[model samples]
Target: MSAAREHVIADLRERISLLEGGSARKVGCLPFGVPEIDAVLPEGGLAYGALHEFAGGGSGAIDGAAAALFAAGIAARTKGHVVWCLTRPDLFFPALVQAGLHHNRVVFVEADKEEDVLASMEEALSYGGLGAVVGELVRLPMVASRRLQLAAEKTGTMGIVVRRWRRQTEASDFGQPTASTTRWRVSVMPSDELPVPGVGRARWFLELMRSRAGECAEFVVGACDDKGRVDLPSGSADRSNTSGRSVYSR
Candidate 1:
């Protein structure tokens, strides 16, 4: 806790951030590429070497898929390979590819239960040179999430927990803390209709439920494309009114 000692530690953190390339939001941080959104996040963006949680708004099928796709897009933004652990085989690679997470860069592990999934994710995160490790869970206890966080920190890998609840009641577990760096609740929104009468791009209602270093915020963004980028809605010519963005706090 000495002043000089603290300064030395800070310098070392900054140096590490620089070595990571574009992950220099503050320290262990990278911009989400959304100006307004990044402005409010700690380090001005999501942090590396930490655990983040994503969940659906309800028990709806599309809601869970939206959360997974959102995490995939974030992972796509990072470098190296991605390991996603899930109990179910419902994930379709073609949709992930459209979200910028190319099929080749990803490795999927199918487990029969949550314990296996968590174990696999922790192992993947411990490995060096991986971009990210994702674990799908219906209920993540604080103890489990903390272990994952510590593992990710050991090597600077990112950990994303995609909470996929099998029942509406199970999702209630999300109300508790997991000591994660950040948490988000994603909901599907009606896509914009083209003049030709068909779907445009997918849209999402992103709720920033928890931020260790930021205030809670909400946004409606166009789903990630082939390059892992989130954008304002195509119809949003102006955002003086947030283009329909909202924020909530607890």
Candidate 2:
């Protein structure tokens, strides 16, 4: 083979190898606050290198605090640092610490604009050392989300986008079309009574909205401990209505 031809072939081979490696590469897992939710996910936790959207019904009504705490709990459990980007400057840090996220493990960034939040989140995810990146954004354009997804994939880090309920609904309605491997919606449920009873137990509904592997189901999980880690709620009967939807009545 001519020297130039040999060089071209070698370059082509290297490109092919990279493509294969990327496909086979596994992303890190962000363990959900709930064990059952983690079990349902393919990786036994939130898959890394992908976009995971948490959709809620309305602003301030979507349980953003609980959701943030949940993500924080995962970061704490994994002993990984969390880069939290929020538009609202008032994040309940004490509550987050109570939810199992250590104050030292979290780095809070308050972004004034949605674009800045996304940009900062992408940078955190790409920094390659953090366990997970959590961003509270109102809306994420498809193109921007795709870029963030690619960045996550490159670093093998988990990216979570918490969409405010009052923002553009299309981002959650049409599935945002990012490189995310899975999507989930979390809502607060009435807590089961505890024997000691201070705040009682915390309950939540975890709905797997979308998944690349295609097995999606709704599960009820209860939070335990001072840090609010979740587990299967005992004595709670599984009730499925005629429409095949699981309903938990308070």
Candidate 3:
């Protein structure tokens, strides 16, 4: 890329970062605040102006709910309203609030087909007004994802694609390549143990499945708090290897 083009992209990134309630000095990425998790990414945070892919570890409802909450928490942290496009109308409103995303901050688009969902996501991402755009679908073709990535890059908006499968067999598609900047898989883990007789905060097993210029790693974290933030449990360690190898290499 030319120097002028690079400068323009950087400026746009910083502008969008500030517009999304981030500090002026911090541009191009959204840090998760946990040192261990942030250290693995090349940007020390989730990059802006990019497309990210996420999916549950399994097809079961519990795993799927975990994945949805993960995306919801991310959207919750941004400043402006969020546009979420999906074929399903079954997202739990209260759960989103618990994940720190208020209902008023989200504009949901219910499309009739997967193709329409992708188209809506691409359009919303290009609008350049929202903090982020989210889409739920079972399959994301490379071409469609590339279009979304380009739209995000053009406007400095983040795009999140949550892969939701109704059948286990459909999940095989997730292994295919895409234009996403990163890919993640979230699974529900046993809740934290409480000294008393009640349940503690939920825990999650997070897998960084792919990254363009970062190491793949895993983490055990307390689920999203009311502020849409996840924390490394006390005494837990980061799972990145010293060599920073990709998960696929393992």
Candidate 4:
């Protein structure tokens, strides 16, 4: 190889070593607002430089909008740019904003086919300096996922894969083809009644299917406010106090 080429390769290797070493150092965690769930994740939040796979729930168990909102809320709270690549262009931004994702931080890229979606997602992941990249596609090949994982690692960003329910068969069979640090399944839970009239709390069941750090478990989390941010349901004592305050004020 030419001297210039050798020099370039050496420089690249040094950069990779720095990144790998820095990844081991603890960066502050970004809370998802779900205490129980966060407790299980490394760094007490989603790990950076890793792939996170979201398994599709059974029919009617979960909807894509709800899942998008859930993930979007996390991205919003982390205060980073999010690239949402989807095969469908019909994303409900209003709902996403309601889920606490700032419209300005989100960029929606629609693809005509699943292949295009994967291609776009890979590109977005490679661009670097993003908070998170979310891809909603039918089926993601294991090789493609591995490439994305490497890109995310180089950028120190998070990658979220939202597989369609119809493709659950293949996705589940393939598992997470990359060296993703974690995998989770999110499903909508029955809404809880709010103290106020005409309002209800959004609930979800988060199943940690795979984690590099530990065993998997299921937890329940509820979304409060119009933004759909997840948190643990209030205790009875807290609820009673809230009710008393409302009554006294009235």
User: Each prediction's TM-score against the native?
Assistant: 0.82, 0.73, 0.84, 0.74
Per-prediction CA RMSD (Å): 8.7, 9.0, 9.1, 9.1
lDDT of each: 0.81, 0.66, 0.83, 0.66
The candidate with the higher TM-score, 1 or 4, is 1
List residue ranges in candidate 1 displaced over 4 A.
1-27, 234-250
lDDT of 1 by residue, 1-250 (tens): 9999999999998777656643332126757789988977977888988999998777766778888888989999988889989888778777788779998899999999999999999888776567889999988888989989988887788899998877888988999878799999988776655789766777788899999968999998887888888887754423221121111111
Better of 3 and 4 by TM-score: 3
Model 4, span 135-154: residue lDDT tens:
88656677888888887777
Per-residue accuracy of model 2 over 136-207 as CA lDDT, tens digit each: 876677788888898888877778887654444443443556556776666676666668855556666667
Order of quality (TM-score)? 3, 1, 4, 2
lDDT of 2: 0.66
Off by over 4 Å in 2: 1-36, 57-62, 167-176, 195-198, 224-228, 237-250
In model 4, pairs of residues that clash are 98-227
lDDT of 4: 0.66
lDDT score, candidate 1, position 51: 93
Number of clashes in model 4? Answer: 1
Arrange candidates, best lDDT first.
Answer: 3, 1, 2, 4
Count clashing residue pairs in model 1: 0
